[model samples]
Target: MSLTLQDVKRVATLARIAVNDEEAATYQQHLNGIFGLIAEMQAVDTTGIEPMSHAQDLSQRLRDDVVTESNQRDKFQAIAPQVAGGLYLVPQVIE
Candidate 1:
């Protein structure tokens, strides 16, 4: 399927975008070329080809999960204006 100049303009209007005649013609050619490429791709025969997530078959590099910093909760809460039951207290805004 190919998009005509009118189709391009119609799509632009539906999307709330302004497109002049020249721009609509350019977009029509671009969109038609993309559809042609898709048609060509779909014409290829891939009877037994398996789908893959990526082109390259590689494993992701992982790092060891370990604690990197000491506990600083006590140090931070010490400077707060209110604290109760190991939690920070805040004023209730909604009834």
Candidate 2:
């Protein structure tokens, strides 16, 4: 896959980026190189390969699901300007 100077200029215009002739040519070469790498990757055969979540074999360590702190809802609600039915009240702005 290859990209032309015109194609690079058009892409730059669409992206709202300023590009001179020299920069456009450079970008065209870079884009063509990236497309060539993608083409090479697509040429590989992986018929029996299984998809992996991670490249290396590893497992996440988890802690025990137990309460570590006591409830302090009453203490917090005591300091609020307004609270009703264990919920804080705020002025409604929308109609």
Q: How accurate is candidate 1 locally (lDDT)?
A: 0.93
- Model-by-model lDDT, in order? 0.93, 0.95
Best by TM-score: 2
RMSD, model 2, all Cα superposed? 2.7
Error of 1 at 95 (Å): 6.2
Q: lDDT value for candidate 2?
A: 0.95
Estimate, for each residue in 1-95, the C-alpha lDDT of model 2 and write its tens digit: 68889999999999999999999999998999999999999999988999899999899999999999999999999999999998999999998
What C-alpha RMSD separates each model from the true structure?
3.0, 2.7
Using lDDT as the measure, which candidate wins? 2
The ten-residue window of minimal lDDT in model 1 covers: 2-11
